[model samples]
Target chain A: MNSSSVAARGTVRVGPSGRYAWIALTAPLAIVLLLFLVVPILSLLRASFFEGDRSFNASGVSLEHYLRFLTDSYYLNVMLDTLGYGLATALLCLVLGFPTGYALARAKPHWRRWGLIIIILPLTLSLVIVVFGWLVVLGRQGLVNQVLVFTGLIDKPIRLLFNSPAVIIVLAQQFLPFMVLSVMSVVGHIDPTLEQASANLRANRWTTFRKVIVPLSLPGILSGLTLVFVLSVSAFITPRLIGGHRVQMLGSLIYEQIIVLLNWPFGAAMSAVLFTVTLTITLIVNKWLKSHPG
Target chain B: MQTRRTFLVSTVAAGAVLAAPAIVRAKPFDNVTLTLNGFGGDFDRIMKETVADPLKAETGLDVTYAPGGSSAAVAKTIATPDNPPFDIVLCDSPSVPELIKADMIDPVTPDKVPNVANLLPGLPEFGQHGVPFMISSSVITYNTEETQTPIASYADLARPDLEGRVALFNLENTGGVLYLLAMAEANGGGIDNIDPAFAALERIKPNIVTLTSSTVSLIQLFEQREATAGALWNGRVFAMQNAGQPMAMVAPSEGIYSLMSYYNPIKGTKHPEAVATYLNKALSDEAIGAIANFFRYGPTTTVDLPKAVADTIITFGPEGRAKIKTLDWTKIAEKRSGWIERFNRTMA
Candidate 1:
């Protein structure tokens, strides 16, 4: 209660004051955000306001690039192509991935481990490497074609590398693990007794699966769908390498605008649109799942 | 409530970004950090020796070499921020537009690096904001051991004999399209004439063993003789030939499709002066010769070389590697999507 003790107590309340810790935390985080995300995004946004060469207008901003993208059939087609392809890839992943995930979740432990490993292998490899492997096999007059031709499958080798098929196939394969992993995480957590109990009620296996298993795994299914949808929508390498420039996906278009064309603002706009679209789809799907109570 | 998560994430992100400009976090002086970003592999060594060594010797700078490949990566870093990992960016021709659009790379006044005059003539058109460093081309290269007949033109490959025996870089860059355009013109169709070119390729559709984006793939395919002929950068051919791969680099009767490599100093680089200095050394006769020797491409320096060095350069000379092709990048850039679409639909 003495004045000296009161001052000592005040010092103890805010002991060891220093600026380094704040700087240490803020600095790295700031660097990551600015260097990786914000700067690119901001530059891209700023670039969109201006067009080709002339330093950004000091006077004001314009929507010239937006107008250009909107008005041009070419770019519109590109955007549509991206959405269509992305949706297709997502759907294909769901179809291919869900069964595999279900099987893995319900299978014997050793078989499940091997299945998970098989599914996860591509996830560990760089995207460029996997796509390159596909091209070597699926390309026109490639190994498969060579084998087929040698076996007299056809008179001519086929062109198979750059197309919608390759794009969808590669994307489904690329994002398959994401779908499987997500679905498996949910399905694995579900009570097997629910399905077995339904079976005990004399529900057929198919009936139990459709009524109990499918409904129960709905959350996981939604998560997997959202995951695959978002990834497929934003996939640049798949469309660029396998889709060719022919199949203009949103991810590649963003890349073309910002990285290739150096139109930062326009690319930013494109990215913003892409982000919104992805978010909206994910939200919608989640809402649908919740309403269904699955 | 639904948006709370996204809003929080974005808020934190924005705050961090706002705080970044002030986060200098100084290291030390004469620690003049020079990040030399360029091509990978042996090219990394040449950059280390030619540009990096001399700069470090004189300036006591901490020169770090980032072995990044492709224009997109360099451009991506430059576009990201005022403080990028790369200080000096060495990019090829196609990337100039990307850099200019982002304004990620500042234009260097020739006065900064007066040595740029020694660069090839047509460089200005290709690189407006950057300096031309070296020239690399997509030329027709073949394994001499594979074919008995002398391969001369792209049309030659269209023969049934070559069916399922050729390798090609995928239909992504202007290089492939340039060759296609040349074939189009030769087939009497012209630059926009993709149909004839497609028709030509269709003849030997089976011959195009694989479509690869990486130069390494094409080289591998050739080395294994999985494919007899390939369209590759002149450097790859020269390097492979020198490595005793039994390959012949042909300037092709249709002309070589090329990307005039340019050196770009990134914007927001505090070491702009140092970066410019390295670029100058890279374009220097000694440095260019060393790189040329290592890479198997011609030097950018307009210096007379020792006869030993003469064997390496792919000179455009009087006929100017006449038969080889230079791409109409503008046209190719415009119709790329359409061409790719049609190509995929028809070929796929």
Candidate 2:
């Protein structure tokens, strides 16, 4: 290469001038995040520390709202229920998605395209539309009930919705694509020759999967778990629609506090608690993933 | 016999003299636009046709409608007191005290809105800070097809026959709170002593199919034959009956709680005069009558309606109005948060 080309390449790399160029390119995005995301979060945290009434007027800095939430068995149960739903949804997605993802990774290119499209089609639909669609399938006098009734399975329509299980099921369906995609990317990158070599050595398919494939795909599994769990815990609509008043999550509680009750300080405290719980779980998972590198 | 220049000058002087009074007599709020939050769907259409459109045509004052629920409007106003999104807020009875306590809405006086004089007696007692525009009540609503037994009173809801068929509004809804109060009153307790209400709710728990804040969900539940009966607004029941939904409503034997909506002018509104004018237009006999006829809601003002329309509205006229058991909304407002927490715990 010419000296001029070499000098240009050097400048384009991570040199002092290149670092400045990187900062210049990313500065607008950084400022936008600071204003929109970080500032709002900080304000939410501040709001949580104050004691307030029905109106938005803050009395003063106090941990009374947090104390109210923490001390109350109802609120604590709601928090635990939210985390439970998250875990259930993640596990359900993993159980269903892992197999589908492996098949997608192993399938022919054309078939894989169609499978991926099928997996992503639900994502394109509106959340409301999807929830309503589930309602149609799970509601009393719904299609499932009709089929069951026609086949003499039951004399009447059974209640299939308005419960935590329904919420987790709907949540898993809603976030399954993320799990599948995560698994597919990692498993697809894994060498097929490893599986062939294992078979040639007389190791069975299950043995190869359990020992070789799963350990190597640990990164994807952890990522999928984190994504699905966070999304499920933060979900308000599915729980509201499917679980009805029987199930109360922190997300819906915060919505009720702020929108229905018009109590911002209490709502903000609930939000902070939710955020802290989610962050702690994510950090722990990420740390474990780092320590047990795939 | 006059010169041309002299004739032209005299004509100009006469024209100026005639036009002076017209310019001085121009409406102060004419051509001014005000934004107000309102219930969307049919309510918005009827409101525009009866109130906004007529006002715009008459006075050149335009009203832009931002559709949302009453609580949402209150929440938005509370978020930004200095710069409210709406100049006028169409809010429920519970929101009035909240708005007044926060000083988020301007207080109405007879001087500000002349039509305040025409309002029904005792209607303004509940909402002194705003104009009480319309009235609905939490009535016993049941599906005629699905409900095997007729529901005549609130007590009927707790019957064993109605098990797994009732759809109720959550505590977040104004109708829900009204129902809770009605239950408390009927069962030997009231707002001050609300223990009986929870005890009553426990009995009715087996009957409740779902608790929701959505009117749409209630309608859907009724349509799907999942829910047979529950407490719902008279206006919604009327609409559903009109739409041939096999739904029927009755003023409960143990009296019904009034669901009143108000026109609250935001405190920091730029055009108070315009807001007053809009309220005046909305409260006019024509507008009130139109709203009553269409929505089957009782009007706040003393506007005569057809016999059929008046009969459909349970809160209309003296006899119908007597059926309404007034609530202590101020007390309700004060104890609302505690009640909500208690309710959530009970329901949970």
lDDT of 2 at B131: 89
Candidate closest to the true structure, highest DockQ: 2
Q: Rate the local accuracy (lDDT) of all candidates.
A: 0.71, 0.87
What's candidate 1's DockQ score? 0.09
Off by over 4 Å in 2: A1-15, A105-118, B1-33, B59-62
> Per-candidate TM vs. native?
0.71, 0.91
Name the candidate that leads on TM-score.
2
In terms of lDDT, the poorest run of 10 residues in model 1 chain B is B316-325
Tens-digit lDDT track of model 2 for A1-294: 876787787743356786679788999999999999999999988888876654366657898889999999889999999999999999999999999998999999999999999999999999988998888898887999999999999998999988888898999999999999999999999999999998999999999999889998888998999999999999988888888889888888898888887788899999999999999989999999889977
Off by over 4 Å in 1: A1-81, A103-121, A136-160, A245-248, A265-273, B1-30, B54-59, B77-85, B94-131, B142-151, B154-230, B242-247, B254-259, B265-268, B302-309, B316-348
Which pairs of residues clash in candidate 2, taking residues 3 or more apart in a chain or in different chains? none
